[model samples]
Target: MTKFKKRPSKLKKFLGLLGPGLVTGASDDDPSGIATYSQAGAQFGLATLWLALLTFPLMAAIQGMCARIGLVTSQGLTVTLKNHYSKPLLYIMLLFSFPAITLNIGADIQGMGAVAHMIIPAIPVSVFCVAFTAILMFIIIKYPYQKIAKILKWLCLSLLLYMIVPFMIKQDWVLVVKNTFIPTIHFNKEFFSIVVAILGTTISPYLFFWQATMEVENMAQSKRKIIVNKRVLGDMRTDVNTGMVLSNLVMFFIILTTGSVLYNSGIRQIDTVDQAAKALEPLTGKLTYLIFAIGVLGTGLLAIPVLAGSQSYMLAETFGWEAGLDKKFPQAKAFYISIIISLLVGLSLDFLGISPIKALLFTAITYGLTAPILIAIILHIGNNKEIMGENTNSKFSNVLGFITLFIMTVAAVALIYFLFK
Candidate 1:
């Protein structure tokens, strides 16, 4: 009896430690992310594989700052911005984030519908998309935050398909390691677009807002005061670093799996997860289809809510309304409504007859163009000790954060240039 009790206690402690990072990291591999990675693998093979390694530190630094900011201030991103910065900057930042994030949500909803079609061919894709959107919104409104988080956490484990499917395929280890360790690049516009896609996929701005708000939710779950001491900040950094590393590792496997299976076979095109799954068939066998479906379904489950919730957080904070997943819908009506509105708008896009594949690519490029501007705001807020206190970013973190911002901005500009010329 004593041993069993101790075992449960240990398990509970371990589970408690995994909060924002797991949610943020799991959400990172949303449908759009998978598309970006799959496209990279299909179009560029293992040449851009090194981006996964390169994105690690940048993502960690950005998300860790967000988490630290939330812990210190106990506020959402827009709320913090409003309270500390001028309204013009807040409004400008909101303008950039709102459109990019809404587009992302629409893409996720469309992707979810696409996956539903893959799983249940008889069901109309539009119906499934609207139904899925409603069901998710209903769950958020009816369920407690803890329940929602737990459900998403379990769903995230489905992404293990990326980890498992690679082993089932015949991989060229020599070339795989060579491409991973030895960097490769092409100066052409397509190469630049792939770079932009990778940037958009890994360093997404919504994750920053989501991580901060979720950290506050995590603290509320434990009934702990939001603390910004050295110990708390250290723990937050560890969580962010762990999550970022896991995210990039997943990115690595995604490209490796697709590159090894699809690109090596001269299959140069993919749009939806189904296409990617079909591409995986020759090397990974029939089971690969099952793996791909599970990955999409699982990641969609994890990601869509964060997308909705982050939008909810920002809008509520912007208008001075009560917000937080922990709050009951009656108490946070504005917040919940904002979430549903974003979701429904997203769902409606699926019915517009836009190709799911095209939506996926559009989502990546749109977000990529907007991410650098948002990152600059994040860097500014994170470095201000008055807002972050002891959790303020170190000089090293600030430098890395700005470098990431620079790279993203440059890639986005290059993408635009190629689009016209």
Candidate 2:
């Protein structure tokens, strides 16, 4: 008789549960996101910390819907949209998302190159930009999906530096707790813009595409047929929840650290990730600054692929060309070329001499406007019985998804109104 197999350790099991959700969540805090959060903290202090708490549940639900759509339909969101929605509508989405993602990629690459220059002043920012562009394009084209995903999961550990930063500085735990749980709103244009930027950076449209496509990628990687199983759905929920919580937790602490340190010190503007890191040196010393810089680099490496991959996935799906990171270069020529073109275009943006902070701010605003449209479309697909079949969103998911859509729409309108006012 065969002996009973020993059970896997709890930690190992939990680690196994993480995948698309974890990567998606971590990628949400890319360089652009860091800059936006830093701007929020430097300008409004802890007054905006409450948005972090508010967004976690909403982010989880929206991403969960995306993951379910992919898992159930066994197709990327774009493919599903192509099959079920009007061509004009699909093209409309592509028009909005493509440029926004490209701009984000450019801003993210710029941020990474800026931080690299700060670490090694001898190298020019253009060099770092070109190097990063080449490296990421190579990784996407050459690496297997599983290998790239594992590397991204490990890179997420770098974000822990933000959490540790607040402990190194003097923090008002009393006020931090109060502001985190209590909602605060400022009606001015700057505050409104920052709020929109924060929301945009947090619940981004690219993550929606990435989440759904990666879930499809996972299915294909597992060699599983397109079938819905209860165990798979449960695992997806756990992964999405854990990932969103981690993303928002980092956002909260980053805001807290900057608010306690830079805002308190009367440093009210962060024009770049380098400036933000440098501003923290006097309060938390060089070590913290170094870690912050490294975090920017690591997250950028993790995020640029997702941004480029999302665009490629949409284009390939729409045009009926083969697409998947797991495929060989020759097997998915159009897909790989799209990724290469996006990276190169973004690299060109770096040489244009746009200020990193200004570029990032503009990227955030673009995401803010585009995200709601995508969210509304996602909600429609998730609720469509033909597309999602029995895997359609439950009441809980629908409520949170609609709430997120509503909030984002209002924020978008508010941003424009305040700008004109």
Best by TM-score: 2
User: Residue 220 of model 1: what lDDT?
Assistant: 78
Per-residue CA lDDT of model 2 for 1-421, tens digit only, reads 9999999999999989999999999999999899889989999889999999999999999999999998988889988889888999889889888877888899899889989998999999889999998889888888999999999999889888788888877777999999999999988899989998999999988899899999989988885475677898999999999889989988998898888888989999997788899888877899999989999999999889989999999999999998888999999999999999999888888778766667677778888998898899999998898777788889999999999999999999999999888
lDDT of 2 at 184: 91
For residues 133-218, write the lDDT of model 1, one tens digit per residue: 88888888899899998888788687777888788878889998999989898877888888987888788877888898888888
Model 1 CA RMSD to the hidden true structure, in angstroms: 2.4
lDDT of 1 at 308: 85
lDDT of 1: 0.81
The candidate maximizing lDDT is: 2
